[model samples]
Target: MTRGFADRIPVHIQQVVEAMVEVFVNQSENIGNEVDYLQVFELSVDTADFFSMQAIAHSREEPPYSTTTEFVTDTAITEKVYIISDDYGLEGEVITYLLASEY
Candidate 1:
């Protein structure tokens, strides 16, 4: 049987985790000014359920606003996949962009 890499050190893990966060950010930006859109992103690597995350949006009303989203090391994924985001909901700056799309 083929075995997966099971050891996660701080240095290597940091790099890998950062890469995953980048994926999330990219997916978020892919939404752009479009509405009624769904962007899906498969993780960079198959992570164990024990992963963690942290997310931050740099700006709300600008093109170059940066958003950093993190994931925890432990999450359950069964049946329907959970789409968790720090700013997915709530009336934030991004909301304006999405709302404007409604005409």
Candidate 2:
């Protein structure tokens, strides 16, 4: 995770984010090769204190599947881009959370 994005994650919902990542991995893997290594996450603040996260498992050959969750917190998450990647950047099961501007 980029420092900016990591820092943007609300303190009270840290565990929620971690669990979301784990669930995203399982959904992607269960779908098999239909999904490519890269995954996408759409994050936003629906309300001033509400954070919405939509994790998408995308595939070039098929339509994307996504899972979403919402959190009510005292602080809103401002950073808003999520992609899955390894140290190599574009390949591997590792998922990364970072701001769109940072990339």
Candidate 3:
């Protein structure tokens, strides 16, 4: 019997994903109190390509705390990843779809 790609993702790849999330959280925190905080939830990935993951980030702060979806693909992970909205910089909730296929 063999397990499918989606059933068993490589440990190292999972670690990389975790690291990316950590960086996002850290960067969001460094922004300021206006950010409140960033939390990652509902993290799902397609291990078939080991290149995509959908995560929901809940950011609690001021009013107009909107939610949006963004796709990140084959790009270096930086503080910019937490820039959810133009109004508050790293403040606001969002669902991020990340694709690292090229990696």
Candidate 4:
């Protein structure tokens, strides 16, 4: 997570990130060889209703929107887009979550 994004983390964003991490972990554990090392997510909130939000994790390999999950929660955080990817460096499989702008 970027320092800027981390400073303003919101509850709703927390929920969505947690959900995405669950999916990532499950996929890695159950289908290690077939899992994608990189995952991209776009988070858009309803301007009229801040309480509602939609998060899309795109995987063009899975057509039909390629969306992995969608979630809704109540909050006023304005996260635009972010990506979670695996970086197998000296730290082993280190996963990172950062804003698109930060990317």
Candidate 5:
């Protein structure tokens, strides 16, 4: 049986997603309070034919309540393959802020 796009997406997008995750985690710790790290609730990436990609990340400290988000970019692309990583300078800041004050 073949896995579907949702399953494959994580493998293909892990690098970028992980980088985004790292930034959020670091920011959480820097907030100078006891913050929680729960888990990633949703992560999706959409790629355009022009090799540009948009990543949407949603995470939460508790289930069913997403508290973080991120958007990454495609760093490399071919006709059929694409690479995405954290757009730390942009999207990373958005997500980090979401969690920082929530704690």
Candidate 6:
């Protein structure tokens, strides 16, 4: 079953996650008041581990962003996926895409 977006990351770690997202956004290229691209970070709750899942920036008009997931042994252990919508918005808009852990 899919988990709720808010439930993916524990309350204690949300701040850390958000801070990391902000750092990524600040470092990314700014294209005409909007971000040039988006980034998805796959995170593991058990190991406190995470990795980037590169995403292509879709039009702001698009409802859902487009992304590609390259399966690796470690990804199967991931418990949550954070989707950062590369746009003009501030860091407060980051969303977490929750995944059911297989391990």
Over 4 Å off, model 5: 1-7, 10-12, 45-52, 62-103
Cα lDDT of model 4 by residue, 1-103, tens digit: 6775666657567566667656765765675534555555655555434446554555423322244555565654555555455766887776566776777
User: TM-scores across all candidates?
Assistant: 0.25, 0.59, 0.29, 0.59, 0.40, 0.40
Clashing pairs in 5: 16-85
Tens digit per residue, CA lDDT, model 2, 1-103? 7786667765455556667666655776787734444545555556533444433222222355556676565554544555545555556355666666777
Candidate 3, overall lDDT?
A: 0.37
The backbone clash count of each candidate, in order, is 14, 0, 0, 0, 1, 0
Q: In what order do the candidates fall by lDDT, top score first? A: 4, 2, 5, 6, 3, 1
After superposition, which runs of candidate 1 have C-alpha atoms over 4 Å from their true positions?
1-9, 33-103
Worst 10 residues of 5 by lDDT: 76-85
| Model 6 residue pairs with clashes | none
Per-residue lDDT tens digits of candidate 5, residues 3-103? 33223444445555556556656776686533343444344445566455544544554323334443445532211122122345644622222121132
Model 4 compared with the native: what TM-score? 0.59
lDDT of each model, Cα atoms only? 0.32, 0.55, 0.37, 0.57, 0.41, 0.39
After superposition on all C-alphas, the RMSD of every candidate to the true structure, in Å, is 14.4, 5.3, 13.4, 4.0, 13.1, 9.5
How many angstroms is residue 61 displaced in model 1 relative to the true structure, after the best TM-score fit?
20
Cα displacement (angstroms), candidate 3, residue 66, comes to 16
**Of candidates 5 and 4, the better by lDDT:** 4
The count of backbone overlaps in candidate 4 is: 0
lDDT of 3 at 87: 39
